[model samples]
Target: MKKVKPKDIKGHIEYLADDRLLGRMPGTEGYKMAADYVIDKFKSMGIEPAGENGSYLQDVTIRKAVTGNDATFISRDSLGNKSELIHGKDFVIFPNAVEKQTTLEAPLVFAGFGISAPEIGYDDYAGIDATGKVVVVMRGAPDSFTSTVAASSMDIGNILQTAANHGAVGVVMAFTNPTAGVPNISRGVNSVLGPDGGIAVSRYYVSDDVKLFSFISGETLTNFLAKAGLDFNTSLTSLKNATPVSAPLNTTIRASYSSSHEDINSYNVIGKITGSDPLLKNEFVIHSAHLDHVGIGAPVNGDSIYNGAHDNASGVASLLEIARIYSRIDAKPKRTVLIAMVTGEEMGLLGSSYFAKYPTVPKQNIVANINTDMPTIIAPLLSVVALGAEHSTLDKPVANAASYLGLDVEEDPEPEQNRFVRSDQYSFVSQGIPALHIKYGNKTPDGKNNLNEQVQVWREKYYHKPQDSIDGTFDFDAGKTYVQLNFLIGYQVAQNPERPSWNPGDFFETAR
Candidate 1:
């Protein structure tokens, strides 16, 4: 087996994170350049094209929905007094992805966290009748819920679906922070389009029944709750305590919005290494990483380009090195290894979601996915956190791989980050494929083992900022270790006869 080289990893990152790539945003020439770079590398490594039409590229049509100026939100009190809320100040409406124009007038109901999980013994909609009404919710789950459960419950898609299940006409997310402003959708919301032209996957719109999805400023929510004979802080306290305070508000909201959409095309670059065993080769093990980033953004310290060096350039580099490692080996694993450098992850896992749902190969033949995204390789690779591994049989491979690499496997130190659902691996997990993403654990040779603290400091300065360029902190040796560890994990899965399986009664088992 060929060892992953730090110099090769450095080379890939240096080229990908160069300023010319313009942050590798989807639907840009810069993004095409980055994709073509991956294609060339795969070709050089003799990796077979496993994308659509026997090419290295898979089409991912992205629809960008921009809220029009005609958007309006009017609130009416029980006495018929109406007040028009200012857009961008009091609230911001998400553009309707399906409907060009939509209008809804309905009574409002406060649904705590908008979660309805009876299995977990919590249903915010138990007492509230949200039928044909607008449901206002805070973006959170009870503290008693696990991190993955909490993240999935609070997901915008799940929230909208939950509201729709209760026959709610709309969903309005209230800002929890007193100083926080409404979200700005000026750049527009993004969603993927299936071959038939309908929405394949989205974070905002669940169905036409849920016409309105918007966010209100903290002050706006406070005043609205006040008129409903409820205190914002008190209601929040009650909800946080799992008391589930839900009631019909005294105010009615009338909302009208028009959306303008612009569809842009992107690609998910895929390549594969065929396995040796005839039967097992029919099944596949996936390696995935996001190829797109936040693109160019507002200037930070005079640098405008949001070069995603650590954000994902390092991840793509790691995958490429993994491909190279496979290329050098004479013996292949029993199961095919599919390397998928996906797109639109920063926009909400669009590319991976599409591929996981509609894979280039037979979906059932896919056994497992090992995702790499922003490994935060700023420190030594002493230990690892295998996100999502514990939920499935993939945990064994992760543990064995970590042990083989002379690394310890630890529980996630920052579960509050909700990283399991924040990356490409969640797409696979959501599609019922057991997956895991490896991240650096808090361990150091100095015995401090406070790497999480150091990562926090690094994140404060660079996580998504333009400062995350090639010039930022990097331990290329750590990058090499990540590549090796991830490659070994996938290799073991590919070689194993029994495919990776979900743990009994796992949270994601029901998804399958």
Candidate 2:
């Protein structure tokens, strides 16, 4: 088989990342154009379509819901006093936590960091009857978890979910960072349908005026408990001892106004090159990259189009290049090689989630998924930060492939960043499929300082903002080597001897 050429890969990337694509946001005309280009690339490259039957498009079902004016929110206190909280004025609210506009009049308990970690033998909601009342927890993790992070070992998000699971009617979490602020709520796209309609993600906040009650911070709640002379560690106990000092805690808030989401049709672009052996053909090697970006935003430097040239335009380029290489290889995989350019990734892995719900191929046969989202900008590639690196028996296959490219396979530098749980790969991982994700190290090309400083500079100034446009100074040279590493992964998985698996003691492994 001939080696993939860097020149050919760049040609496809140049066209896809061109200003014409308009950032390739899903459900938009520009997204349609990008989708069409992807299918066309497959046709031109002579890659066999492996979507459905013989089609190139694996159509995914999606439901969009916009908060209608009919959806109203209000609150009443113990004195039977009530106030109408205006919508979209005070803060943003999501119907996500619970279906109906939850009305909580029972005692409001301030639960300290509402975290529960069985592994650590701790439960924040322990011995608390918080069924109908709202528990005000603090933003971020508890002290125990923060200490673990400083020692390079921390995973508290899972513990945070305990509040919802433990029957807390509603949760009000406050921020501790006075300098930095919490992320504003963003609009959600419902990919999975529910008994009511669809399960929508959280909502973007509106300004003050719509809130049913006052919002309290963790610091303030903690202070209130401390002033009451109760043990702070015993959160519920403290709340129980401290008698109510106020008649009603009411705060006004509002939710952002957007068109109620309508069902938007979309598809996952898939192409495949089948293997030779019959038994091996049943197996698969999956290569994926998301094709969605933040659509239109307010405006940046007079340009509203966020031509996400670097965000994932770089990723799609890598995907297409791999497809072209696999298509032209003299010898194909022992199993099938799947090249997928998934959609709705910006919308909570919606496309991949939909694919999991309706797979074109058997989910059991998929060996592993390699999803590339953010690429290594001009920075050097030192190691492969495989997100679920420890879960699978496929680590050797990755190392074998990496060795072929003279690259090292390493665990993610920022697992705390939760890249494993952040991208399209998580959609498949949730279903027990082993996944590998590679990204760049946090260092500048010139090695002047850690890339985190610059990234912080960019995130504050550009991240997800209209300012995230590509500039001349960005280092893109890493793309070539990055693709080299991926090409090896694509080939090796296609020809690997054993299937990847979730390692022993992995939570997802037991789920499967």
The alpha-carbon deviation from the true structure for residue 241 of candidate 2, after best TM-score superposition, in angstroms, is 24
lDDT of 2: 0.59
TM-score of 1: 0.95
lDDT of each: 0.91, 0.59
Q: Candidate 2: which stretches are off by over 4 Å?
A: 66-91, 96-139, 142-172, 176-183, 186-259, 408-416, 442-462, 465-477, 507-512
Q: Show pairs that collide, candidate 1.
A: none
Instruction: Give each prediction's root-mean-square deviation over alpha carbons.
Output: 1.9, 6.4
| Displacement of the residue 153 alpha carbon in candidate 2, Å | 13
What TM-score would every model get versus the actual structure? 0.95, 0.76
lDDT, model 1, position 429: 83
lDDT of 1 at 485: 94
| Stretches > 4 Å off in candidate 1 | 178-180, 226-228
- Residue 306: error of model 1 in Å? 2.4
